[model samples]
Target chain A: MQIYLPIAELPISIFLVLGIGAAVGFISGMFGVGGGFLMTPLLIFIGIPPAVAVATETAQIAASSMTGAIAYWRRRALDFKLGGVLLAGGVVGTVLGVAFFNAMRRLGQLDLVITLSYITLLGSVGGLMLTESLKAMLSARKGISAPLGRAGHPWYFGLPLRMRFNRSKLYVSVLPLLFLAILIGFAGAVLGIGGGFLMVPALIYLFRVPTAVVVGTSLFQILFTMLAAIMLHAATNQSVDIILAMLLVFGGVFGAQFGARAGQNIRGDHFRLLLALIVLAVGVRFASEIVLRPDELFSLGLIEIRR
Target chain B: MRRAALALLACWWAAAARAETMVLSLSSHRVQITSTYTGAELVIFGVIDNERRSVTRQEPYDVVVTAAGPRASTVVRQKVRLGPIWMNLAQRKFADVPTTLAQISSRPIVQIASPDLRRRFGLGLDSILDPAGYDLIYDPTFRTALIRLQREAGLYRSEERGVTFITPSIFRAVVPVPATAPLGGYDVDVALFSGGVLLAREDTNFEVTKVGFEQAVAQAARQHPIWYGAATALMSVAFGWLATVIFRRD
Candidate 1:
């Protein structure tokens, strides 16, 4: 089936788009990542305009995060106090990111910035995940329980404006949490991500939150952050493609539902390793495009019609 | 120039002999862009009334048909290697360039007209790009890139010797409009050339417009962006809720 995207002014295969959404959604649900690291790049590979892909993907992320956050809310696993503080910083970061995005777009350098950021982010995160998961898998096979590592460094705890988050059983400084949230928030807004991969690790390692509560807290913060991004892109840039967003949301919501059940049957360490491999593969492919010469060195864009 | 003048005089005499100079029609004048619009082809056919002229040994009349979509500004960006990566370094803006262009002729355009004539009529792809209208500096690569990219995208085409003559005075050509072609008024120009000179010319209009659901959606997205944005967010959230409801039953 062929569907015409109004904003992008192009016709795309309906089934192809649905399949991409489902695949990314399944991976995100199974691994507890937001999947934007994979989804935004895939959308661009399939010829969706970069601006539309970024804005529309953010809209879809907002929808998917809402579903995940609700499930965690029902389970009483979300740390509202920590999530709220992160969101406060996230709002400020999103505004700055939007301005930066607009500036890059005007200079015709937005595509370069987006590709470079993805390459940097996915490369480091995927590499770390692969090593950590491999060690965990090896330890499990040897029938040895690995002791829980210390969550935070002394400097992170020494920051001012300390607050107690009873839900995670941690008393952490608000400054570090706010600073981390701002950084992730900027990344989420610019990269069209929910920042789950970055947030989950930060929550567990930097703030010393319980691993059990990290996924829920990350999803809660991501929901609000992506919601703000969607509105900003729509109102300011008018780049969000509703048709594209709806198709992705439809496939993503259903895929995540099925994926969650499939996740229950798999070993945690094995799935983590698999997801890490996929992330690293995507990052490598992105990097190769930059390091390699393009088939066509020149490109054209229709002048933006401002009414 | 002398030959062109004689050809014009002959065409005037032929027109004086008959009431009709030429008759032109298209397969479709209004192209409706529905949800299933993949592409379209217009069969441009015309009849030349050469009734008064003797059917003796003479040069066969050549047909050249050109179609251009609505004009708009376009920007072409050239990438330069900067350190480790290639980035957009310079941009050239072109004004009044057609979003889509298709030209079909009975013979190779070069054979039918001289370089000056081709440029004057905007016949061949190379010379059709108006040099005076672009930015201050004249770079041949930018012009070539613009046409090359558009052609690759199926928005521009030049099909030499594509027109066929079924009868002595009737000719037809098929012009293809790609799926990505913009929606607007398309101008089709048909010219009859004899002895390498233009004899008779006719102009027709082809309209491509969005209809039904496609029109409504495109209009709302452009005109009422705030409402459209709110609706998109709401719909996405609803989809998520619907999925949760369906799956939670398990």
Candidate 2:
């Protein structure tokens, strides 16, 4: 049933929203990741405003992550020191990201930038995951460990501003981390993503941070970054609807809890493969928009702006 | 006990014997009608006083204006409630509710459109009957016509609970005259009803007049391409972002 709520006056189909929440929650519980990569678009498809969707999604992520973080802390799985470092960088990155976001808005090209970035990043990550997972699955059927690539050493290593990351057991400089943080920050600000996908891989492959510490630290950084984003958007635009956020967050917390438990039981390779497929499907759908023409694109003026 | 009863009876008799009358006048008694979009406005003014004693309580009133013509009819209603004399008796727990005086004095002007006029302007069929839908088409022309009708309708007065009353109120109601509405001389009647009973009536004449600003803007917006383009572009960007976020993977 559709209901008019006083808070936002949004005509919400409560049943539909809850059902979507349950399904997404289940997936998120099974996977050790935020389901925003899926939920935001689904909301839009159902006619929620885009700005409302993104702002609400961030609020949902905050709640979900808080629940997971608490559970992990209770179980002694959290690495406080590692989480702290990431958070420090994340805060700085968020500040810079918000600045960039405002500048883009003034240019009236913020939307274009956000769209292009999502397409490129989602497309690449999805493709990579799919390929790697497929290969792993094929190799496992033959009773063989897939060949792993060694970390290649560059001949000239004269990069400046090196810093030691004790938890990762690496002596890499601070420069790369700063650069990576800045890029992630921009993505976070523009897309309202936590940038965990990018951070996780970078932490594992580049810094060689232990896999156990990776998820925990990344979640920590995301928590800080997302909070900053929520605050910035709220204070500047008054665009964050508390009602919408509350609904998504209510669903997300339980989803994350279930996902964490499921992650423990599932085989890592198989889980990764499923995630890869889901990502690839989303990527293709997004790319199709650019390739396909829409029906009845309307305009009121002489110079037509095609969307 | 006998003395107390006698005093109470005497007070009741005195209050009943002293009834007050108030006079209300409008600046313009007749207004020219125009396109569905325009009309003459009447300014209403009046006074109230108790014949026996100064009224300690403020009076409440309602104004209604209606128009009738061939093919369409419309009504505009405004209400005012004066503050009670006993307002200082308590801390005013119901501050949110408007006072009787406030309701009668000033109100958002109401617009009424004849069904034929609405159709002529392409206002669609549903808007004519639905209050919400009608509000969506509240153009300047309709508003002006409403104001004019209210001005011409003159003063209305009513009493509720005998002690509280309305004086010198104004109302306008619109009705469609038949296709044979007289070109130069149209007889307009104004009637006052209290407790649903006719208290007074007046007759006047009017001539219909031309279109206004709001109608023109709405027409231009509909015909212009640039406006549509801008609106679409904004919607796409908003929707596009939503699509990307929802489909993104961890």
Per-residue lDDT over B108-215 for candidate 1, one digit per residue giving the tens place of the 0 to 100 score? 998887775676567777766866323356668998999999999889998998999999789999988878878888999987777676667789989888888888
Instruction: State TM-scores per candidate.
Output: 0.90, 0.53
lDDT of 2 by residue, B26-137 (tens): 4553333222222233334334334455433243332222222212222222111223111111111111110000012122212222343233222222222234323344
Give Cα distance to truth, residue B6, candidate 1, Å: 17
Using lDDT as the measure, which candidate wins?
Answer: 1
TM-score of chain B of each: 0.86, 0.23
For model 2, the DockQ equals: 0.02
- Model 1, position B86: C-alpha lDDT score: 78
Worst 10 residues of 1 chain A by lDDT: A145-154
Q: In model 2, which runs have C-alpha deviations exceeding 4 angstroms?
A: A1-9, A75-77, A99-111, A152-158, A299-307, B1-250
* Backbone clashes in model 1, listed as residue pairs: none
Model 2 chain A: worst 10 consecutive residues (lDDT sum): A298-307
Q: Per-residue alpha-carbon lDDT of model 2 for A1-307, expressed as tens digits?
A: 5533222324466667766765676676677566767777677667565555665566666555555455455455666665665666777777777677667655444544555566788888877777887888888999999755466633222367655556556565566666677677667766667777678777775666777777766766676667766666554433454545645655555555556566788777888888878877876776654444423121111111111
